[model samples]
Target: MNITKLIMVLICSAVLAGCASSNSGAVYKRGEARQVQTVKMGTVESVRTVKLEGTKSPVGTVGGAAVGGIAGSTIGGGRGSAIATVIGAIVGGIAGSAVEEGVTRSDGLEITIKLDSGGMIAVVQEADVQFKPGDRVRLLESGGTTRVTL
Candidate 1:
């Protein structure tokens, strides 16, 4: 190959390499906000749960991919144009699904207890407990809210 053609190929390869590396190891943080509510101590009737459903739609994925593929295809034309667009759409859908999965949340439960002080303390409980429904428990209150730690 001529020196000019070799140089052009090298430049194109470097640009593509840079593009590939640009998306590597990207980290995103999602925040959760909890509201505190006060309750009086009462018998531990039942553990109540708060269900958080995933709001990501599969249509959103395919739609976003289709749009991105069209935009990508516009930049590359001819016999490879349709194929390139389809590939772009597929990649975009997978990326969108991953993002949606990261944001999806599930249900959490909080325990309610009646205190000897005649006050009710409802506490958010974590999974991994050896206690049953009728087990005697202690409530710890912080910032006007209580949690059953033990």
Candidate 2:
């Protein structure tokens, strides 16, 4: 493939892979579809804004390396080209990881809920919906995962 096309493909693949994962409370994984969840009533004690970090998967790193190696191969001839390719790959890997993280990072919320069962617990999830103290909400629990919803 041509250099530009290869670079575009690599970038697109990395981005798509990163987007495939989610921490949103409203999104459910395939395995969670048929499972039952325990529902608990609660009052929102507080809602604090939080930052959700992105995926650190190898897709970004490998894609970046491939692109960088190709670009660097065009730099010079013989041993010099090979060395440039290695350096380029290393730099590209680091940059790709950072780009992936930035692109996939999302705003989240740390919610402190006072359960009606007389227990206090906190859950952090993507801030797709607004929450404030004193709002009535429900806690859905299943397979060691908990999500707060209104």
Candidate 3:
């Protein structure tokens, strides 16, 4: 191949490799913001049922893959390439959706705490609290609530 063609291939490979490693150090900050309070009064009036919403179905992945495959095939030459593209898309879509489903799930607690001021607040608590519907608890300001062990 000519030097120009070889240089183009090398540049493309470098760009793609860089793109692949760009998100290696990306991290997500989890947990809620902390709050400090001098005095707070609350009584667990009643534990309410908090139905956690199920994750969204991974329909987007399948849809995206199918769309991508069709777009990809258009770049190659001829009818055979178009057919290959559609098949590739169908396979990609199923694989992508499966991966998406594996990653999305429920993560926290849904609890309703009633304060002494006759005010009520609903929040997600830690899983280790072992709180159930009808459990009494005390709301703490440091992003946590203590189950009133009675």
Candidate 4:
């Protein structure tokens, strides 16, 4: 493979990555105004790790395929080169999709809270904040999702 083409392919992959994102990592979306949420005081009972689903977008696969095809076409002449391009596209697409998933996947938490009012509830959200048992925390509820913040 041509070194220059390979470098170009890697650059394309990096550029395309910004086109795909998952709602898994951040506590809130940037630049979007949020409404006031219902706040409930509670004590952390337990905190456990959870996996946030990764984004599934065509950006990575398409970008990788394009890059790979271009790189592979440089490999030989005529029919053999065409075959290599096709094979390279297929393999690159799959690899790119896996890489995207790995990059977007996030660590989450399953927090069990004991509400001061005498009830137990669990909230699962991105583990952006640290929580420990016996910690005083606030449960913020809005938009059908709940989050625990210090």
TM-score winner: 2
Q: Model 3: how far is 15 from its true place, Å?
A: 20
Scored by CA lDDT, what does every candidate get? 0.50, 0.84, 0.47, 0.78
Q: lDDT: which candidate is best?
A: 2
- Could you tell me the TM-score of candidate 2? 0.91
User: Per lDDT, what order, best first?
Assistant: 2, 4, 1, 3
Clash totals for all candidate models: 9, 0, 0, 0
TM-score on alpha carbons, each prediction = 0.37, 0.91, 0.40, 0.82
- Candidate 4 lDDT over residue span 58-142, tens digit each: 8778777777777678778899999999988888788777777777788888989999999999988777777899999988777
Q: Report the lDDT tens digits of candidate 2 across residue range 10-88.
A: 6667565646577888999988998999999999999999999987777777777767777777788899999998988
Which has the higher TM-score value, candidate number 1 or candidate number 4?
Answer: 4
TM-score of 3: 0.40
Local accuracy of candidate 1 as per-residue lDDT tens digits, 19-74: 22111111111221243435333456457765444445664465456554654576
For model 4, name the residue pairs that clash: none
RMSD of each: 11.8, 2.0, 10.6, 2.6
TM-score ranking, high to low: 2, 4, 3, 1
Model 1 TM-score, 2 decimals? 0.37
What would you estimate as the lDDT of candidate 2? 0.84
- Poorly placed runs, candidate 4 (over 4 Å): 1-7, 16-26, 30-34
